[model samples]
Target: MSIKDIDDIVVHDISKFRPQEDISLDSTKKKIVEKIKLQLKLNNTSIRKLAEKTGMKHPQILRVTSGENYNIETLIRILDALNLEILIKEKDKNSNDQLMNTAAL
Candidate 1:
């Protein structure tokens, strides 16, 4: 069967599909950027000040936090300067099973 056939047959329940990984990643990235921006605002720090504090270029900081090209190492340094930690956790078993079922469709 063609992809269109699979798409038609598998979409029985719109809500059953788990978010695509890239969508989740983008959401996570946006959240991190917002947190970093908030931290800067709360501290009354400008991008230039943050750059000086983190030893990163101002343009690079702007680009990363603006959802352009993202660099994990640079983001880590910035987050460290802002005293933030990244967390990772696995989904509960039911959620995992649901996602698997959705993907197999």
Candidate 2:
């Protein structure tokens, strides 16, 4: 079945972004989700419009923005709807992780 046919598919788990402090997105993916939420708020974008634009269910987008777990395909669709993209580059020598951040165009 296609994405629409299986829109309810999901597996919930604790976020890897275990806060180092009271509030933080310590993981790269978590940071990206935070960025998406910020952009959506800045642009006054609604989940309804985003779902329509990306052909994804509202719950799917909610899962992503909530920093729950989401597959790459869902993330890509959301990024496309928000005019955003992920950027990858060599990690700094001092950095402990390889994952990078995203940018909005």
Candidate 3:
């Protein structure tokens, strides 16, 4: 059964989830980061544990969670460790929000 309309989906507490360092990201990057944050929350995993799994230090994961750094390789590794994968698909340009919000991480 369909759970909800894509446009109706909401991710709660992304901004308040963790202490972030001062970081600047364009709106698209910020949306991606927020979706990643949501995925982490959904997986019930912590950055420290993810670090241990990925052989990366806490600070590196912290950059990802905090939006200070988002090297694609780093994100891919992190997502892989979480048993997640990215699937990019074409969407209507006017429907960017739903496309990103419903991205399969």
Candidate 4:
């Protein structure tokens, strides 16, 4: 069964977890980098291991974890290696509300 929702409270749909109105690209990139580092530590995973899993070199992974500029494909590969995926959500102009394209990854 599905969980009950709180009255008068707006929440993101569990079936479609997404967000909109993201910050600037640079800021988002920085945030992603920070999150990756934290996830690595929390999961007790290391950059070297990630490098091996993604077929990337340790130095490149270091550059990514060190906050150096990286390409989007590289980011995707890194996250994929970590068993993570990125979601993209957009705002609906007609309804003036956020819409999540949670069809599938």
Candidate 5:
């Protein structure tokens, strides 16, 4: 059956749609660091090599790659060195699930 062939479709009210909650910077930063580490591994780069390329300390880079808390500036530098850009957008305030779904998409 085609979508237009359906006779019992219901449309939800957009006014009732909830906005999504924003993710904490810490959680988002951690995810970004992990992704960068994965990409580095795929490129055959070591942790030390990444640190050197980013002009960050080897120990600090290790901590970041291991999911330790680091400053936003440090994270930004690392991402930039990896050719990644951080995009920040104000999230809707009603629904966390919706925000996550949108981000995933």
Candidate 6:
């Protein structure tokens, strides 16, 4: 099923589920880096090769790919090297399945 369909079908107050304590930016960055690495199959590339291709140090590449702390600049560089772009969108306030179906078409 499309993400929109799933989003429409599933009803939950995500705001309530958010952690009470502030989440560390490092943790958030690490999760995003790991997700991108997995999606792009970065692990298949050797550290030296990735470093050479991305113009980043081998250690930094390893750290970012391995879900360790990485700077935003590093993340952007890695994404650029992989020819990927990040998109940020606000969720629709209306939970309309019909809208989702139309969007899918």
Considering every candidate listed, which one attains the maximal lDDT? 1
The segments of candidate 1 whose C-alpha lies over 4 angstroms from its true place after superposition are 1-19, 92-105
- TM of each candidate vs. truth: 0.67, 0.64, 0.57, 0.59, 0.58, 0.51
* Global fold similarity of model 2 (TM-score): 0.64
- Candidate 6 regions exceeding 4 Å error are 1-31, 39-44, 91-105
lDDT of 5 by residue, 1-105 (tens): 887868667656542343322344445656777798888878888888888998888998877787777788987888787778888787656655565665554
Model 3 weakest 10-residue run by lDDT: 16-25
- Candidate 6 residues 3-90, lDDT tens each? 8887788545553444423233444566677676675675576667778998889898878887776777998888777777777786
- Of 3 and 4, which scores higher on lDDT? 4
- lDDT of model number 4: 0.73
- What stretches of model 4 exceed 4 Å from their correct place? 1-23, 91-105
- lDDT of candidates 1 onward, in order: 0.81, 0.74, 0.72, 0.73, 0.73, 0.67
User: Of models 3 and 6, which has the larger lDDT?
Assistant: 3
For model 2, the local distance difference test gives: 0.74
Model 6 scores worst on lDDT over the 10 consecutive residues at: 15-24
User: Among all windows of ten consecutive residues in candidate 1, which has the lowest summed lDDT?
Assistant: 10-19
Give the C-alpha miss distance for residue 6 in model 1, angstroms. 23
In model 1, the Cα lDDT at residue 101 comes to: 68
Question: Which candidate ranks first by TM-score, i.e. highest?
Answer: 1
The CA lDDT at 32 in model 3 is: 65
Candidate 6 achieves a global lDDT of 0.67
Model 3 segments more than 4 A misplaced: 1-25, 96-105
Point out the worst 10-residue segment of candidate 4 by lDDT. 96-105
